[model samples]
Target: MSDSKYAFEPAQFKVICVPGDGRCLFRSVAHGACLRLGKPSPSENLQKELADELRAKVADELVKRRKDTEWFLEGDFDTYVQQIRKPHVWGGEPELLMASHVLQMPITVFMRDHKSGSLLTIAEYGQDYGREDPIRVLYHGFGHYDALDFHPSGAKSKLFQK
Candidate 1:
């Protein structure tokens, strides 16, 4: 991973790369969810399965919250939900929001700022759940996302330091 002026020290966090299948976002979230739960990382096959399950749950959550979400989504909300249910479909901010609601946990998205040459928090979801330990994901500034985990030694990220 490239150095980031705003990132935690390389030793503080490890970036776990997931398959680049269109489901990268969901896979990353699933992987992070495992870490958050104090479980070992799931196998690649398990991750894919978890991603699919999460996708389904997210679709359901979207339908359940259509009144509050339809305004921001593009095109027909029903169509969006159907499209997202497919395994190859890629998810973005809307899906992430729904995932947070589905899992009832906070999710934090980070990205490298090209201009500042630093990693930065770009978006967050599920703040109502709490902020103590969010499911951390690093967006590659494109369409890809990877999970972030602190070292087992318990070193904290400087980005979160006071």
Candidate 2:
């Protein structure tokens, strides 16, 4: 908040707004993953690539675990699998769950709190079982998704500033 440590380095908290063009969720996930992986200011192309990779990876895992399909998809697992691989489709909490499972990481969503002028922890995606030393991603979730970042500097991050 106003502390020198926070002022000089803000890696523990940050934000990134993704395009609200229906592809925000995937873009958010991709960017978040990249940030977690230590790639500061990951490119749009790289985010898309990461999202697509996660989609395919999660989809395949679902297909293999037939029993898990009933919880995530509606009618057909095959159809769901194909759709998730597409760039245009949006992902939701279900996708996040699968992504966390596939990657074995924790995804923390920081929702904007207009009243409090701070973020509210809506949900975290790695509570299933136990995972030690997990990579973490911060997300902004409204009706859409946005990737959040942290900067270890006093100034704001140019790549993620509003």
Q: Name the best candidate (by TM-score).
A: 1
Q: Each prediction's TM-score against the native?
A: 0.86, 0.71
Tens digits of per-residue lDDT for model 2 on 1-162?
011111112233556766776567667777776667677766777766666677777777677766865665776777877887776777777777777778666765555555644455566677553544233334444467777665445355344346
Report the error of model 1 at residue 2, Å.
25
lDDT of 1 by residue, 65-89 (tens): 9999999999999999999999998
Question: Runs in model 2 with CA error above 4 Å?
Answer: 1-12, 128-142, 151-161
Clash pairs (backbone) in predicted model 1? none
The 0-to-1 C-alpha lDDT of every candidate, in the order given, reads: 0.84, 0.62
Task: Report model 2's TM-score to 2 decimal places.
Answer: 0.71
- The lDDT leader among the candidates is 1
